[model samples]
Target: LFHTLSFFYMLSSFTSSKISYHYHFINIRKNWTEAQRFCREMYTDLATVENAKEMNNLLKSIKDLSYDVYIGLYRSNDFKWHWTLSDSFYNGEIFKNSKHISNNESCAAMDNNWKWFNDNCDSQKQFVCFNGKICY
Candidate 1:
C-alpha cells in the first residue's frame, strides 16, 4: 500500500565476476543484522545488487511494486554503502543514496520501484539471501 509496508518477502539472484550468485527471499520479518545472520547461516549473504541492471532486474522480477525488502547494502562508519557479500563487487557508488541518508539509519532496503532507502538496522523487514559459487 505504502513504501513503509511492514511485511513482505521475495528472492532474486544473478552472476558477477567469478561468482555465480543465487538469491533467496525470506518471508519472515527480522532486523537487518538478524537477516544477515540467517543469510550467512543458510546462504552466502544477503542479496547483492552490484549495479543498476541487477536492481532493475530484481524489480522487474517481483510481481508487486509496493513491497519494501532488504538488500545487502549497509552504511558503514565511513558513511558509505557496502554490500553484505564481497566488497570487491562494488568499487564506487553507482547511485547517490548516501546524501539523503542520516546518522541513525544504517541498513538499506529497496522498494519494488527500485528506490533505495536507509532504515534503522533494528527495524524488521523481509530480506533476500544469496549463495555464491565459483564459476568454472
Candidate 2:
C-alpha cells in the first residue's frame, strides 16, 4: 500500500510539473521588433522553438507556409544567439545552418521548410506567439 501511494504521488508530481504551451500564429506581417512588441502586449513573447516537438507545433499552427515568419531568435551585440522568451529551452538542433555570415543579419525567421535562418530585423514577416501554462 505504501509503495502504491508513493507511485501515485510521483506520478501526480510528474504530471503537474509538465509545462504546456499554446501557440498563436499571427498572420499580420510586421518587422521582428514590432512582432515582439505585439506579442508582449497581447500574449507571451514571440514563439520559442526549443525542439522538434515545438517546431512541429509551430508548423501546425500556421495555415499557410508559403511565407516566412519571425521567431524569438536574435543575435546580441556580441553575436551570441538568444531567444526573446527568457526561459526558452534551446539545444541548437533546429538551425539548418548555424553560420551567420552577415553582421546585419541579427533576427531569425522560420522558412517554409521549418528551418531557421537569420534575417534583418526590419524585414516584415508574420510571427507566432505562445502562452505557457504550468499544470498543477
Candidate 3:
C-alpha cells in the first residue's frame, strides 16, 4: 500500500510540472517596442519560441499567413540578444542556419517560412504573444 501511494504521488507531481503554453497572434501592425507594450497590456508578452516544438506551436496558432510577425527577440544597444519574456527558454542554435540575419538587425520576426529572421525594430509588423504563466 505504501509503494502504490508513493507511485501515485510521483505521477501527480510529474503531471503538474508539465506546462502547456497558449499562443496568441495579434494582427495589428506595430513596431517591436510597441508590440511588446501591447502584448503586456492585453495578453502576456511577446511570444517566446524556445525550441522546435514551441516554434511549431506558434506557427499553428496564427490564423493569417499573409504577413510576417514580430516575436520577443531583440538585441540591446550592446548587441546582446534577449527575449522580452525574461524566463523564456533559450536555444542557442535557433539562428545558426538563418542566412537572412545581418549584423545591424536587432529585432526578430517570424516570416512566412516560419523561421526566425532579424529585422529592424522600427519596422511595423503584426506580433504574437504567449501567456505569462510558465507551465513547468
Candidate 4:
C-alpha cells in the first residue's frame, strides 16, 4: 500500500512539472504592431493559441475590451495566415468562426465565441502575454 501511494505521488509530481502556467497579463494602450514588437523585445511573442484551452485562458485573463486586442495570428510575408509566435501552421483547428472586418485588417482578434477577427493593426487595445514572459 505504501509503495502504491508513493508511485501515485511521483506520477502526480511528474504530471504537474510537465504542465506550466506561464501566462502573464499586460494592460497596454498600443497599436497591434507596436504590441507585437513589445512582446518580441521580451523574448516571447504575443499570445499563441495552439488549442481551445489556451484560447480560453487568454480570453479569461483579458478584461472587457472597448477595442479589439491583437492576437498572435497574422498574415506572413508569404501571404499565408500563420501564428506570429508559433512554428506550427494553423490547420484551422481553432477559431473556426472567425471573420474579417475588412480585407485591410491584418491583425487577428478574439471576438464573440472566441472567434478571430481581422482588424487594422493600428487599433489601440490591451494585449496578452504568455510563455514565461511579460511586456509593458
Candidate 5:
C-alpha cells in the first residue's frame, strides 16, 4: 500500500574523516518495505530528510516530479515516527501529535509538490537511498 524512498546525505558544513556519501534516486518502484530492504542490502538505508534544505535538495534531485516517493520515515505500531538510519535510533518528536487522514497511513512520502504526506505502507513507488557511514 506504500512505496519506499531512498535518501543519502553528507557532512558538508563540517569536516570529517568518514566517507561522504551521496543520495541516489532509484527509478524502480517498490513498496516501502521492499525499498528498505534493497537500500539496506546495497546502500546504507532509506533517505532521511532532516531539514528544509535537504527536503528541497531531494525534490530537486528528481528530474521528474510527477509521482511521489517513499522516504525512510515510518510509523510504529504504537504510532511513533522514526527514521530508518540512525545511530542512537531516537524517535521523532515531530508529528508525534499530528492528525492524519487515516489510521492506516503509517508511512511517509513526498509528493510532486515537495510536500510530505502520510501514506499506506503498501503503496509502491520510486525511492531514494542514502550512502555513507558518517551520516545519521
Candidate 6:
C-alpha cells in the first residue's frame, strides 16, 4: 500500500509540473530591452530556451516569421554573458555558430534547427514569453 501511495504522489507531482511549463508566445514589435521589461511586468522575465524540447515547442507555437526574441541571457556590466532570469552562468553552447557576432547581439533566439543565435536587442521583433505557472 505504501508503494501505491508513493506512485500516486509521484504522478500528481509530475502532472502539476507539466501543467506549469508555460512558454507563451507574444506577438508584438518591440526592442529587446523593452520586450524583456514587458514580460517581467506582465508575469515573468524574458524567456529562456530551457531545453531543446522546449525550444522545439516554441518553434511550433510561432505562427508568423520567427522574429528575434529577447531571452534571459545577456552581457553583464563586466561584459560577461549571464542569464538575466537568474544568476546562473550560461555554459550551454547554444550560439556557437552565430555569424552576426559580438556582445552587441544582446538577445538570443532559436534559429531553424532549434539552435541559439544573438541579435541586437534594440531591433524590433516578436517574442516568446515563459511563465512557469499553471494556466487556468
Which of the numbered candidates is closest to the native, going by highest lDDT? 2
The lDDT values for all models are 0.66, 0.69, 0.68, 0.57, 0.67, 0.57
- The TM-scores of all predictions, comma-separated, are 0.72, 0.74, 0.71, 0.63, 0.70, 0.64
For residues 6-114, write the lDDT of model 3, one tens digit per residue. Answer: 3223222221223455789998999988999998898888887554456567878895668989988876554456677664333344443444446547788877656
Q: Give the alpha carbon lDDT tens digit for every residue of 37-57 in model 2.
A: 999999888886544455567
On lDDT, the stronger of 1 and 2 is 2
Q: Write the per-residue lDDT of candidate 6 for residues 1-136, one digit (tens) a residue.
A: 1232232232221111232445677788788788788888885876654444544565566645454555666755454556566555554334434444565675665443434556776778777677765457
Which of the two candidates, 1 or 4, achieves a greater lDDT against the reference? 1
Q: Please give the distance, in angstroms, between residue 52's alpha carbon in candidate 5 and its true position after superposition.
A: 4.1
Q: Write the per-residue lDDT of candidate 4 for residues 70-133, one digit (tens) a residue.
A: 7777765454567675455553423233443344566776553444556777788667666643
Question: TM-score ranking from best to worst?
Answer: 2, 1, 3, 5, 6, 4
Cα lDDT tens digits for candidate 1, 1-136? 2232211211122224566566677777898989999999998888876544444445544556456788887777777666777754233433344665566687888776555677878888888887778878
User: Which is the better candidate, 3 or 5, if ranked by TM-score?
Assistant: 3
Give the higher-lDDT candidate: 1 or 3: 3
User: What is the lDDT, from 0 to 100, of the residue 45 in candidate 2?
Assistant: 83
**Between the candidate structures 2 and 3, which one is better when assessed by TM-score?**
2
Evaluate model 5: give its lDDT.
0.67
Which residue pairs show collisions in model 6? none
- Clash pairs detected, candidate 1: none
Residue ranges of candidate 3 with Cα displaced over 4 Å: 1-19, 87-104
Weakest 10 consecutive residues, lDDT, candidate 1?
4-13
Candidate 3, poorest ten consecutive residues by summed lDDT: 8-17
